[model samples]
Target: MAKDSSFDIVSKVDMPEVTNAIQQAQRELEQRFDFKNSKSSIDLESDKIILVSDDDFKLSNVVDILESKLVKRGVSLRALDYGKVQPASGNTVKQEVKLVQGIAQDKSKLVIKAIKDSKIKVTASIQGDEIRVSGKNKDDLQAVIALLRKEDFGIELQFINFR
Candidate 1:
């Protein structure tokens, strides 16, 4: 009997890259003319990033700079869930950017549904935060990968552990 071909779909972010992005953004913030003498700052916590600025406009600029750095470092913006700006101490506006590390439950359901609806000869099962797709035919597995690539799952999906 032939073993099944399989691959895992996951949404993962490289924390080191995120850290580098934050450092670059901070460096740029310090040098930007507009931010000079401003209290704009970006801080990375365990699973989230904190952005604080003197006002809403500055906060937005901070977010843009961080996003550009993240993109340049090959980090998907989708992995960062933005929170609403709120007032912080010292009259600064603050925003929390949550880092998404895995395929959410709703998103997992969507992945399974899309595969089932495609009527492809394969099976998709959710294992914790990742989805495992398997089939007897390698061609079918490739087809499923193509199908998933065309669909927007709202988050960045990576195909890994292929066999």
Candidate 2:
């Protein structure tokens, strides 16, 4: 009898790394020549990040710096969902950046469809925030991973729990 090879597909981020990135962004904002006296700030509240600055230009720069820090920390840019810039107190502008942490039901369906369309002789089932792929052949499981990697799901995907 052949045993099924399986793996889980997931999208997850390291919160500690995000914290470090935020701290680094704050330090840069303070030391930058243009940001001095600008009243620009960055705040991380649970799953969301708030960026505030005196104007559009400063706000844009702040976002750039924060994104760079996140990238350096190995956090994928695709995981960030940016909100519209709005006016804040004291004439400052603020933007909210939400950290997208999980694969939604809609996205899970898309992944399942992609796997089915690949004709790779494997089966995929949605498991909460992730998808489980299984097949009798290990080569088919690897092929599923490759196919998913080639498609842009607008979110970062990681394969784990291979067996």
Candidate 3:
């Protein structure tokens, strides 16, 4: 008998990197002239980020700055599921950016479908927010990974736990 080669596909974000990006964005918000009087602010909660600004224009600018900081910190923009800007108390606008940490059921189905459709000699199974792919040949596993990379799943996927 031979051991199966396998890898897990997961959508994970490094919280420390997110924290650093938020801190950098906050510093820029405090120092930037445009944001000085705009009263723009960013707050990171357990699984979401809160952005507050005086208006929609400033709110978008705040998001852009945060996104740039996040990119600099190697955080993919796809990890963020942004909410619509809504009016808050005192006429301020607030937007909630939710952090996506796992593969949803629909996405998992897509992954499985893609792998099966590709006719690759591999098996993919969903393992609670992650996909486990295994094959007798390591080359087949690598091909599956490459095939998945070429598809746009609307989220940042990471391949890990290879064995």
Which candidate achieves the best lDDT against the true structure? 1
Clashing pairs in model 2, backbone N/Cα/C closer than 3 A: none
Higher-lDDT candidate of 2 and 3: 3
Superior candidate under lDDT, 1 versus 2: 1
lDDT of each: 0.96, 0.94, 0.95
Backbone clashes under 3 angstroms, per model = 0, 0, 0
**Per-model TM-score on C-alpha atoms:** 0.98, 0.97, 0.98
Model 3 stretches with alpha carbons more than 4 Å out? none
Name the lDDT value of residue 66 in candidate 3: 98
Of models 1 and 3, which has the larger lDDT?
1
Give per-residue CA lDDT, model 3, range 1-163, as digits (tens).
8899999999999999999999999999999998777778999999999999999999989999999999999999999999988899888999999999999999999989999999999999999999999999999999999999999999899999999
